[model samples]
Target: MNISDQLSITAKGNPSKTAYIFQGEKTSYMELEGAVTKFASSLKELGYEKGDHIALVSGNSPYYVIGLYGALRLGLTVIPINPIYTVEEMRYILKNGDVKGVITMDLFMDKFVALASDFPEIHHYIVGDTGADVSHAQKLLNDKMKSFTGLMRTAELSLERPTIDDEDVAIILYTSGTTGKPKGAMLTHKNVYSNAKDVADYLKYSPEDKVIATLPMFHVFCFTVALNAPLMNGGTVLILPRFSPEDVFKVAKDEKATVFAGVPTMYNYLLQGGEAHKTDFESIRLCISGGASMPVALLKQFEQAFQVIVSEGYGLSEASPVTCFNPLDRPRKAGSIGQNIWNVENKVVDELGDEVPVGEVGELVVRGPNVMKGYYKLPEETAVSLRDGWLYTGDMAKVDEEGYFYIVDRKKDMILVGGYNVYPREVEEVLYQHPNVTEVAVVGAPDPNLGEAVQAFVVVNDTITEDQLLDYCREHLAKYKLPTVIEFLDELPKNTTGKILRKNLRDRVTQ
Candidate 1:
């Protein structure tokens, strides 16, 4: 079945139920289904045939959802782009993905207009006006330009979904190019739908659940967990424009949100918000954590402060973004990504692709229906990632005797200090234990004497000297693992998903 069929089924059972709540505005299941159908019909009228590529670049909004589901409903491959990308950055994705059209917000109108002339393949432009005025230069482009709202209203509603095979590619999610240029991971309809359904089932999602959709939908984690899983389960999604600890807490308490999902950085920020800014998370039944590993200290602190339990999971963009999550029915392990979810299998293996013994650190490999079809137009990269049947995640991890997986760090992020391997996450975990440290990211900086030295970038909640923080790390970490330098900043850099950008820290320090 098509992914859009989830809405139709939910609407049939709960037509009047709230499907999405954005900025206090409510859209019922039936209404959302109608909008998606109308928008899909409109795209069809523009001659966007099945298997064509259409890009959707925008922040969290109702229009983004409509565009996403509409494209999927008609079997068009949706390319999700971060709206903040520069003209050059977006141009690369559009050209690489072979995008035939784009649906972007008015905020990005200028960028598109500037780059439109370079790509004649993009024939249609649907602009979502988020209270932003459009540019007058729309007449310059050869493509037809129309407001997204206008199309949704004028197009005839076609409840009939186009024939979409389960194996048809649905979304092409580009990776955050920390290592090199980004490559799009082609997620098929079955790949996404299977993961969403399994995620909803694993999390014990019910129709009564109200999920906080704070993470950007462009990323696979939020696309499947916060958006697709909730929709598939007939739950309500409370949409937030962006992640703000204060705003998230207020909305959770005000809207009575039952489930909240976010990354470690968000959790640290929420913890740093302290008692004064703390919202009664009494309304939240369960909190989900991903994008990055949650520091064990921060996880415990937040649980105590907010009076809620947070289950952390692990996955990359290539695996339909979810391979393992802490099961709701079992005892949630503190730092473990938990066992593999239903129908998914995970193993920690060495360089030879053979599984290591329990408690041995190695690469995490996953195999399941949820795995992506392959990387778009990059067969060599796809072959490297997908071997035999398992997708090598390139994440250093270990599984306990109970089969709970613990992410050690990204293999590329491991530091070689004086020929001794040091995982940045181990040092960051020590730094997080400090009373004053709110957030920390560790990286390797060039050191003539020792090959490489450990340097830490930290965000502190209290007035603490760098020396003192380093001294605290010294006490907890081994001599080799201790950070040699500590730099205090107001905040650490993060991606749209709130994952701490360690590569950025290394770049700053090396410069």
Candidate 2:
């Protein structure tokens, strides 16, 4: 079943229950359903039918929830974009995904104005007011613009819903392009709903649970775990715009939030807070750590300080984002990603697709309903990723005899900085655009707080300051993908075929 149907079922069962609490406002299940129905009807009136694509570009808020479910209700594919992305990055996704409309805050109206000419295919620009004057935004957007609040208020609460197949695409998530440009991973309705149900079952979510939604809603981890899973199971969500140690503690105590999910950096920050011990985290029953490997020391320390158990799990954007979560019934493993959940099957295979010995390292492959259909509009890439019935995850991992899996390294040379994926090639491509750079290589460096940091080694013909190069990157790259360290090298290490040896550069950083 589609997520929209699951939400309707929950609302019917618990009409008076609180669906989500944003800031100080609480929206009941009945109210959320009404708003979603109204928004869906409004979109239909504007000629948005099934199989159309719309982009949701905003931070975590009630607006995000309404837009997401509304689009899904009409069988429209939702492309969730990071609100902080550079204009160029946003343009690439909108142009590549063939987006027909955009749902974004008024603060980002200027960026859309700059990109309007580049992509004339985008017909509708729905602007939500986050303290910005809607009248001024409408003036800039012209007749094509529509106020988000206006649609909700004027539209009727009735829609002729489309018959959405289970295999139809629901979300087209763009992975941080390891090759060069980001490729969209198409997640079907079944892929998303199955993963959410499995994750909710594995985590033991119940109606009485109140989950903290501090992680970015755009990311798959938070989208499935902190938002979809709870709402599907008739639980309440406490929304936060951004992550702040002070804000998290206050919300957890005041709202009595039971489940908190975050990356390792967040846990480290909370542990470093001087008043962590005194903070009333007693209401929290479970803590989830994902997006990156949790350092054992930080995990142990945080549990001691807060008197709560932090269960670590593993997932990627392609697998509807979750494959394994530490089982709640068993003794939790410290470093493992736990075992494969529910109907999913995960195994380590060698170069020839043969299963390796239990303790040997190999590429991790997964097969299940949760795996994505394929990359959008890239048949060759999809064929390589999905061979036979299994999705070949490019992660080097080993499984113990007890079936617990440990990720050893990334075969794709990916860097996980503060739980966000940063590809070396994506950063290298941006640096190559500079005229002064003759050659360049980017690698992951050891970081104390972020787990890993981006470092660049350059061989340049002309003089260029690090600040100057960094200023250029800020225009094209996100803040998390910026290189923290820049080293001047005469020439990069290379093999006989003239391929830059990235392993050597990574070793140099560690040394």
Candidate 3:
């Protein structure tokens, strides 16, 4: 069944259960379903039919959830965009995805007003209420503008539902590619629903589980694990507007949240002042880490300070963002992403698509119902990524005899120094072992002698000289793998989801 139908079943069984709690406001399942129906009906009345594409650009809010399910309920493909993206980035997706309508917050009305003249094919501009006065923008938009709040309040919930198939595209998630324009990954209904169900089952979510949603919903990691998994299992979701150490701590204590998910950078932040708030996460049983590799040192420190189990997983946007998670029943591995979950199959393959021996690093590949059908409007790129029914993930990984998988680094991010393969993650892992080091990232720097030299970027809590760090690394890393230059930063450049932007670091070296 599609996600909307699954939500309907949960609502019918527990109408009064709290579906989500946002900004101290509680929304019951019945109320949430009612709003989704009304919003879908209003879109139908506005001439938006099945298979139409709509862009949802907003931060974490109840309106974001409503707009997502509302569009999916009517069999329309929803393209979620980061609200902080520039006009150029936003325009690329809208124009390339062939979006027919847009649902955004009133705060961004001015941006739509600027682009309306260029995008005449976009028929509807539905703006959600953010308490901003959009009078001038509305006047500019004229007949094309529609109020998000007004549509749900006035529209009836009697619109006919479309027959959505499992193979039908539901979401077109754009990947944050390092090199060129982003590629949109078209996920089918089965791909989304199956991943959510498998994740909920693997994590052992139930009606009593209250999953914290602090990660950005626009990203696939939070979309499936934090938001969709809980709802699919009739659980409560605590949605924080943004990720902050104080806010997350307060909400976890007040609401007794059972599960919390975040990236490695967030885990580092929580560890900075986490000792005082140890009791704040007493009710939390599980902490999930993804988006980037969790430093083994950081993971152990956070787990000890908070006294909670943190499971690190691996996924990409093309696979509904989840394929493997550390098993809760077994002794959790520190650096491993754990075995493949449920129906998904993960293997490490060499360049020729042959499975490599255990304990050898190779490109990771995945095959399952969760993998996307293909990239939207990019057949050549899609063929390169997806071949023989298996999605060839560009991540370099290795598996253990026990079937646990460990991500080494991105294939493209691997550095070649004097013809010897030098993976940055291997060096970063050594640097993270320092007591004063908080976060670290390594990249290749241009060099005339060794062809390319290893460079390190580090964020530390206390004073540490380049000589001391290099001396410490000499004991662990090989002479060829040692970094020639070390640059200290207050914080690393990261994307919206907090993954370290190695590409940006590489660009800095070239400049």
Highest TM-score model number:
3
Off by over 4 Å in 2: 134-136, 274-278, 414-511
**Candidate 1: tens digits of C-alpha lDDT, residues 402-461:** 889999989998989888999998998888888888888999999999989999988887
Ranking by lDDT: 3, 1, 2
C-alpha lDDT of all candidate models, in order: 0.89, 0.87, 0.94
The local lDDT score (0 to 100) that residue 155 gets in candidate 3 is 94
| TM-score of each model, paired residue for residue | 0.97, 0.82, 0.99
Which residue pairs show backbone clashes in model 3? Answer: none
What lDDT does candidate 1 reach at residue 47?
A: 89
Over the stretch 1-511, how does candidate 3's per-residue lDDT look in tens digits? 9889898899989999999999899999999999999999999999999999999998889889999999999999999999888888888999999999999999888788778888999998998898999998878888889989999889997669999999999999999968899999999999999999999999999999999999999999999999999999999999998999999999999999999999999998888978789999999999999999999999998988999999999899999989999999988899999999999999999999999999999999999999999999999999999989899999999999999999998998999899988999999999999998888999999889889999999999899999999999999999999999999999999998899999999999999
Question: Candidate 2: how many backbone clashes?
Answer: 0
Kindly list the per-residue Cα lDDT of model 2 for residues 94-114, writing each as its tens digit. Answer: 999999999988888878887
lDDT of 1: 0.89
| Count of residue pairs whose backbone atoms collide, per candidate | 0, 0, 0
